[model samples]
Target chain A: MTDTITIDDHQVPFEAGQTIMEAARAAGLYIEHLCYNPAYQPHGSCKLCSVKVDGVIQTACTMPAIAGQKVESDSPEMKSRRKTLVEMIFAEGNHYCAFCIKSGSCDLQALAYHLDMHENSFNHRYPVRVIDASHPDLILDHDRCIFCGLCIRASRDQDHKNVFTMAGRGKATRLAVNSETGKLGDSTIAADDAAAHVCPVGAIMPRRGAYSTPIGERYFDARGIDEIDNASGKL
Target chain B: MRSTTPQGNCDVIQREPGQKIRIASCSLAGCFGCHMSMLDIDELVVEVVHHLEYCRGPLNDVRELRDVDVGVVEGALCNEDNVKVLEQFRANCDLLVAVGACAINGGLPAMRNHFGLTACLKEAYLDAEGVVNPEIPRDAELPRLLNRVRPIQEVVKVDYFLPGCPPPAAAFTELFTALIEGREPAFDEDMVRFD
Candidate 1:
């Protein structure tokens, strides 16, 4: 049997263990995803990567690739749904990009641009959160966290430090430190930890790296994030 | 292609046929980044002049406002003068297009919105590390400042919005083409920016 699947018309070949997203990405396709880091297993935290497989919508990261399965992405309807997802996430957080250290490189901001979120489809919630600067080398600005679980996955799966965790229910839910002191400085998280480097937003930042890269020189400055299709690149 | 009204020497318009469109522009409490970006259209300005004529803006030395077919406004409304200029543009133009992030959501100037007006003034005039005179300007001749900087939509009805720190020149080129062709201007994902 041919180990190929059709995604938005292109025939993508896949290996036995690769997920639909992994296969599509390997074939140089850009699927809108926020939470599926290649280093970690697919968590499916953000549903922006939803694609139609055999006329049913499914998250691409968790779906396994199969030969002859027809997958659809980049359709106007799918694009609209992805746009709505981005808008909802944006409204739920207090992400002000102008002053954010990760302004140019923020994944959420880049996604918003990619989806053409010209104006807020929903009203700005303006919810405020505290900035946790207790960490010596890294500061956790809770306001910017979209609760995507990248830090949680990175800390636990990659660092094996379990320095971060989720707590509370629904709206009250938040990213929390695992230390008894409830402060990042009190935790074992170091500036060099892989978890500290994995935040897609400005939430987890090294103290002195802000503004090190000048504006217009950073990612997604003059070009869209999808301009290049590097098979090994992280979106 | 412009022709002055022989009767009303004050009013000048295109002498050509009914195809010419008048356009005016204004800059508010901003760094004029949008204007610079517009100028980046380069030699295409000659082609643009063939369709649209300047009414009142820094593009010319004219210090007065005139009736126009379209008004392209940039920057945030931060002071009383900005409000007056915006109202003038609204009153004179048939359509108003808010250009750039400042016109869309108040942009960087609206960063002051997080802090109250008094606190911002105090920090800038009295409390800043390098401040010397430490006096908030209260001259009667000066325009009064707004409590917070606001987007153009906050002050007047905006027909369209082009979002960017300074939207790329290609965006302006596309917008002008659409407008000149009598179609609704559109911005795709490639042309808009949040940061």
Candidate 2:
């Protein structure tokens, strides 16, 4: 018999090693998340995917799928908690979505839309971050980063370049390059590397690649993130 | 209804009776796109007109800002004029609404916060690839620019914020409807489209 788990009352079938995120995605269910990728081990960093697992709050990305396990998602309380977490992300970074190249298709922007974020209710940190334009093919705008560690994990875990790491902690934490110079151009992050593309926001995007797709024609334009590839963990 | 032109019976303009919600709108250091989005309400603008009267705005040439029920300010607070306008909104209206990303968090105009005001002017007039007397414009006629572009909330107490470059038209409709009905303007996920 196929082992199945219940997520938000939907019976999701999973393999032996599948996490709740993977099972939900396999069943075409959308569990809001940011940092858990299927290509690598699940890392619960964003916490936007936090759901009630057997009546306790647990990250769906990290929780292993147990047959008949009850997972509660999409509740009003869950949405409120998720909204708070997303609000914190907006507060942490100066996410100017208006002029951003990744404005239409950005996952963070899409998620913000999904969460009905009409205002950045939290105090705006307005951290003056650097816009690194040194890379030949890519640009890194640290202003919009939420420090989800997707690039950090993807760099070391999948690309094997060890090109990204999180330096500092708490509010001062920032995404850093692996090279001695600490610049993206100085690091081994190529334009096509998995690390380069794992950024959920506009922090990492190809140079001059923005606005190529018009406002209404981008990836997340007409359809939400759930419809397009599950957007599961930058995978 | 108010503003209705009486036919040949009389030359009098019969205005709407009773208490109509007063609205005041302004565009600060912005592209005036939000106002355009406001107009994008299409035929539904008639509904807004039915409920509210324009006390002061670009939609009409009304100059004086009376006691308004709602103040809609669009764009970032960049120069002295912008500040004056924002303060006027606060003093004139009971509820102040920041209508776009620019008003909420500085938006595109606030991109100059990174380069500083001096560098921004120099880059535009002096450094850009151009040939001429590339000098920054300085005159008493122009409003004095602030050190950094600031969001409207930083300058005044904003009651609500509608996020977007210029926010969608539907968002404005929802907010207007909610405000007209004396309910809180809370956007659901389906109504949020930042682009």
Candidate 3:
């Protein structure tokens, strides 16, 4: 049985096993999501989708909407909190979008634009990451990694190969190659493996025409992912 | 498909393709496009060459394989020979640069380290190709190939890394000029894909 949940002053229906994110989307609400790509399973790592569920700030992406639940998807307090959260991600990682190959076409960049995040609020977490180019078809630049874990799932599910996995814990958690020697190039991953591709950031990109997209003609402005998503009936 | 030049060498470069400083390099076992991108600098080639040397064609007038001021090395060190070639340039050149995705991270060639070398060689030459005898040759002085390719840094340290499939030629020219001027290269932080 699906019933409406009291959210703020309005009532939004909650369906069984319906994630708050999906319900909100169905109710015509835009929640900030970067790592929780619909193509893959919901990865609530970004924490940008945090909403006040029954008066507690919880990740809406992972939490299920329950009956009689009081939710606050957008509020002045939530807006600032979400903006601060996004700023933290931006500052923590070296998200210099202008030079990035994924600059224009990146979801993070689009979200930043959507949220009006001009200045990074958090201090830069200058993590010295290793660049793994072991796979001939793709490159792994950890410096550009936001810990989205899209590649990990794509490798396991779409490619039918467990080539990429998360290693360590907390801030130390990083994407590690499945090689016993702890090297990606040495892994059994083929050139066409999904792990070798599908990097949201330039952290994973093709080797042939590396930055061939040129300056003025990047992914975002050139194609406009929002327009593309709308055209593809995704957004 | 890539074509060879009339001179029997792979003619991957377009002749007089503008005035850009051309650096013909190779990525053995690693991605080979680093050198190809140098030519891909397209119309910017001439502008880039205006700032540096356009060393192309028969290494004749170039004379002596003396150390170049700025050398771009792509691919990883899979064998001793790869190490030697990289080492020579590192020691001889003023600014030994590692370009392309391979030289930066061992790239796709390094993926072979997961499986046995025998499996990889067999799959490529014996299983797929039209070769009769695929076993190791007796008189082949081919240095022992490693089970995987590694970034150039693992074998020999590099002064700079111009990453990408093969980093854009604009980057090469900018980096080369910056090093020559004894200045830290000014990269448009917006231009590089840090992720």
Candidate 4:
């Protein structure tokens, strides 16, 4: 008999070593996350997937699924907490969705809409950051980066380029390039690398064919993030 | 102008027995696109006028805001004059609604927040490619600019916020219809958009 875990009252069977996020996702449940891509190792940085397990708060992506565990993810309290997390992400960066090419397709924007986040409750930081446009094919706009480390993991683990790394600490932490010149243009990352296409926001963008698709006709325009994720069976 | 019969019968709209709901709207440091979207509510404006009185707005050309039931504000606070206008709206109106991305999060204009105010003024007046007379304009008539552009809620309490580049006309129509009926406005999934 397969051991089962309950996520929001739905029973999900999980194999040994599978995380709660994996189990929940396999059961066709959406837990609302940003940093927990299935292709990479679980990164618990973005706490948008924080859920209560047995009445204690835990990150669903990193926590191992145990038999008879009760996970509460879609409760009112969890939704409110997720809203605050999303708001902090917005306020921490200069996210001007109006003009961004990634407006309709960006996960951050889609999550905000999904959570019904009308206004950012916190004060805007408006931090000044470098826009690294020296790269021939890629433009790394640091302002939109949420520091999720997806690019870092993709470049290091998949592409074997080790081109991206996080530098500094706390509010001063930033995505730094691995070249001696400390610039993306001087790095070995290629345009076709998984790192180039893995960013959830507008931080890393290819220079060519940016505006080929109109804003209203893009990914999240026709369906909410949850609906799309459910239908596609991927985050 | 007064008309007893509405252009089209709207069963959802209901007004107080004797008093018409007074409304005021303004555009601060914005492009007035939110106001344009409000106008894009189209023929619904005909029904809106029957139950709501335009005390101060682009529709009525009234300068003073006083004793209004609702105040619709667009744009962020970029200058001293904009702040004063927002304060006036908050003081005179019972309910204040932020109508767009600019009013809620500083939108496109807030992009300048990354660059300091001094750099912005200098770049515009002196460092730009075409500059015959390089002088930062300073007159008592001109309102002083704030150090950073901010949403209206930062300066005053906002009862509601409709988020969009300019919230779709359907969002405004729903909000107005709900308010006129004395019910809380509920936006559909498609009605709330960031871009």
Q: Which ten residues in a row have the lowest lDDT in candidate 4 chain A?
A: A226-235
Instruction: Indicate the DockQ of the complex predicted as candidate 2.
Output: 0.30
| Candidate 1 segments exceeding 4 Å error | A2-6, A11-18, A64-69, A91-100, A167-174, A214-217, A221-224, A227-235, B1-19, B46-50, B57-67, B77-92, B116-150, B153-159, B177-195
Compared with the true structure, what per-residue lDDT tens digits does model 3 show for residues A149-210?
Answer: 88888888888778788889988878888888877777777766666656766667767775
The TM-score that candidate 3 achieves is: 0.50
Chain B TM-score against the true chain B, each candidate: 0.85, 0.85, 0.70, 0.90
Candidate 1, residues A44-124, lDDT tens digits: the string is 878989999999999999999988899998789889899889877865666667567887777888888887776544544
Model 4 bad stretches (over 4 Å): A230-235, B1-16
Question: Model 4, range B1-195, lDDT digits (tens) per residue?
Answer: 111121122233345696788889998878989998988988989989888888898767889888878899999999999999999998988778898989988988898898989999999999999998999989999999999999888878788788998999999999888877777778898888887
| Cα error of candidate 2 at position A22, Å | 2.4
Give the clashing pairs for model 4. none
lDDT order, best first, reads 4, 2, 1, 3
* Maximum-lDDT candidate: 4
Write the number of the candidate with greater DockQ, choosing between 2 and 3. 2
Q: Compose the digit string of candidate 1's lDDT tens values, residues B23-73.
A: 888899877888888889888889888887776788785757776877889
By DockQ, the better pick of 3 and 4 is 4
Residue-level error in angstroms, candidate 1, position B88: 6.4
- Candidate 2: where are CA atoms >4 Å away? A1-5, A11-13, A229-235, B1-19, B45-50, B61-63, B79-84, B116-148, B154-160, B173-191
Q: Which whole-number lDDT from 0 to 100 does residue B120 have in model 1?
A: 92
Question: Residue A138 of candidate 4: its Cα lDDT?
Answer: 92
Evaluate all candidate structures by whole-model CA lDDT and list the values in order: 0.78, 0.78, 0.62, 0.86
On a 0 to 1 TM-score scale, where does candidate 4 land against the true structure? 0.94
